[model samples]
Target chain A: MAEARRRILVVEDEYIIAVDLADALAESGIEVVGPVGNVARALAVIEAEPLDGAILDINLAGDAVYPVADALRARFIPFVFATGYDRSAIASGYETVPRCEKPVDGKRVADLLFRSIADR
Target chain B: MADDSPAAAPSPGSDELLRVVIESATDFAIFSMDPSGLVTGWNTGAERLLGYSETEMLGRSADAIFTPEDRVAGKAEEERRVATAEGRAIDERWQMRKNGDRFWASGLMMPLSAPGLGYVKILRDRTEQHHTEMRIRESEARFRLLATNIPQLVFRAQADGRRSWGSPQWIDFTGLSFEDSMGFGWLDAIHPEDRDATLAAWNDAAEIGEYYVEHRVRRATTGEYRWHQTRARPIQTGTDDRDVDWVGTMTDVHDLRELQGRQQILMAELQHRTRNLLAVTQAIAARTLRASASLDAFSTEFAGRLRALSRVQGLLARTDQGAIGLRELVWGEMEMHGDIEGRVTITGPTVTLTPTTAQTIGLALHELATNALKHGALAHDEGRLGIGWDVAATRPGYALVLDWCESGVALPHGRPRHAGYGSELIERALPYQLGAMTRLDFTADGVRCRITIPLRSANHG
Candidate 1:
């Protein structure tokens, strides 16, 4: 038996950042679930698909990604936050989640995602 | 012995003292009147103070020195009777001088009863003091009027930091009356968290004679805390260099404070956005560098991608509506190739797109147009291109379907040997970034691509 390609969701609103994130994840030999632009689409993807892990932008357009974080936590799924904001910008309870700042290194994020998923 | 009895030795003889007092007393007019209230004698002070001469005033009736109104009212007769019965009479009234001018006179008349002279009278001019007192009354009235009418809370305190007075406005605002706010009781009106600091500032001002501080105060109307700027200046009573009183004004600055707070947050947000934009630009440079084949290719492609991003950013900034129209995005990318009069056709209903969607689709359109000019359709003079879109109602949720078809030009020898960044962007980026289903193909006619995305997620403006 062979291991399945890990489907990881990417939630961000910035266009180039989203594309680059998807490309980075794909290059890491893991399947990408979404590069969802907002919270609603990210929630829809989470509901309709079985994701191994997820990477989230702290802000989607002008809305905070806390609702999506709450949902992911409720389901016991592992996730990391990718943001252009400081750690203080994240809401409480989600502070312990790993964060990768924007213009993140691809391999570093890949390792973070795998480690978070493995812990889960 | 003489030195030890200085008090008595310094006092001159009675006769000489009388002559000196009568001759040298310039501030007091000393005169004598006969029993019938007739002027018998006048001194130099009387001449100077009343503009009268002893020759002209002597033997004249003392009633002559009274104003006509007082004379008609029998005030002089009443003064003579009072002086005779009680031995002394003191009065303040307007009196006439020899020049017929009136002056404020504080006068005292006493019975001498030493045979020749029956009574002695002394008069002092008090006009300057009277005017000064009147002016002080008027000024105090004006200050009270202003303090009561204006919106600020006015207060007066002693040099020891004890409040002595508070205007009606203060009572109305803080629900503390003048007596209630006396001493340090006014501190109760300040917010608890700010009370100690406010007291400290006030104490500091006591030493410097200047009080200035901004802090939160409780409003009596709703019991809510609001910011106020309280300032005061010390009133120095004389040249003694000691503060006598403190006059202060507390202005309601809650709205201004809130505006300043919002401005700080806006400044911080602006900084965050600037950094994020730089990060985005850096990411584009890295991705463009990775995709280019050579230095020239990197420069051209990187500049083109940056231009695309900048154009979309311009549209977003101009609208400020946070969303861009789909028709505008399409035309912005295609108009660069020249007119679409006969060579290209764009047909789509006006639809607005979120900034994120506009940016992603904008880059995708740039790739498609670049490909059309390089290899497939626009590369030939006779090629034709048609781009159209429609809202599909097939599924429970609607979908936006867009089609790109190039005709009138021969296709390539089959599929190309390798797929470049252009194909990967159209086929892979659309699905991965936008959750859209995309198809790209090369037929014998030209290149064609179709895209479908859930309207709920993709078409929301």
Candidate 2:
């Protein structure tokens, strides 16, 4: 039997972006987890689910996703941010993490997250 | 002392008519004195005006009516000596009455015969008029003190824009002298653009009884135009309402306008909204590409979605409350296709959504209705579509519960859940953006979606 595929969580507040991103990840032969939309739900999923990596949109609706980003960091999981905001919006501790500015493509987000995980 | 009786008006028997006229001339105190300045003659007018009768005044010195200070200063003797040489000496001064009350007396003395001789005199009391003039002088001094010391620039003007005077504060603030500020010269210190409006307000003051205007006035030190509020009120002159004069003041309000500060903030906000909108357009195009079978199909679907986005942006732009109503969002998408007068029913308790939430939900609604028109309930005449929403309590807070259902249609086989854009937005976007709880059921009859989204004014992160 083949080894289990990596389960990557997609945390994006925009529905179309999340669906497209989630579909793109699935097309690449990886097991995709939730594309949770809010900070609280994303935190819950991060706490309970088994994940290889995650992608985040810095703003979920109007609330910043820093708390969710903090949770992923606490668990030692690697993730990349997709944001309409500039790089300065991210917390200083997570400054070194990759950022893919919106109008962002899924492949770039995936590559950045997996690369971040491998480096760690 | 009794040399000449010519100072008396006349004997009663010789000029009875003249004597009666003199006696009854109650406004004047007609009396005479001999060359020695003693009281030699008296009349009833003198008695009434001076509070003295002929019996009490006879043989008394004419100087008896002089005030103590005037007598001490020899004013009575000097007047008599001047009258002897000049034919008449006129003086108005404080004189005493018999009861010790003081009256302001206007008196004239001339020589009874020649210089260094006794003199005749005439007197009139003007005490009430003098008191009134003194009161006016005192109030004017008090007003001058207040106007100069206040921080605001004060002025006196006619109903026209012509100013009669400006306070010391006005002169100091505008660097304009009393000469330069007179008439319409004060307009030179106001901003050119604001002068016309200020003058117009001033012109209307006659009918309105007041002048009020907000304009820019130049500060003399900095030579900069600053915002100032000027107000003037008419002071009516008693019964006739004529002889009106205006009292006005100008107060600086430069900091309150804050025009530049607000413009900078709006610039930043505009940039942010623009960037976010572009990102949204990119997302729509990408998804439309995924769901289409051909380039032509992609173009049509993508265009429709873009129009939906534009409509929502239009709604967002016009909303003064920074929110869009739920009913507007739904009908906005539905009406874009055509009127859903009979085919679709929408009911909801009015609720508002934030810009971010409205944008996301608007896309979801577009896809839902579009899908129905193309392949679902809206495609069949027998099908029915119902949309309803109401507020309900949830764990964290209250939320808007919305139901979208289509009946009298069969779910097409081989169409997998979450395989298309409509289902994706409904199932994923709503939950992501609003923390919404949603359910989409593809049953034996038709498609149904229920969503619960929390209600709150949006907060910008």
DockQ each candidate and list the results: 0.28, 0.25
Candidate 1 lDDT over B1-461, as tens digits, reads 76788676667889888888788987899998898888888999899988889998888887888999998999998997899889899998889898899888999999896644678999999987666666766766887899899999999887555898899988999999889899988988999888877878777897787888898888899999889999988865333466367888999999998998798666655655655566577777878788778999999887877788788888888886677887888888988766666899899876677666677777888888887888867888889999998887756677778898998877766767777666776787667666779998877788888988666645543
DockQ of 2: 0.25
| Model 2 CA lDDT for position A98 | 87
Model number with the top TM-score: 1
Error in Å for residue A113 of model 2:
4.4
lDDT of 1 at B23: 84
How far out, in Å, is residue B458 in model 1? 12
Q: How many backbone clashes does candidate 1 have?
A: 0
Q: RMSDs, each prediction? A: 6.9, 18.1
lDDT of 2 by residue, B370-434 (tens): 88888778888877899998887667667788898999887775355546777777776677667
lDDT of 2 by residue, A2-120 (tens): 86888898887767677677887887777888877778888889889999988887767667788987888888989888776665555678777788877677777778877887899
lDDT at position A62, candidate 1: 77
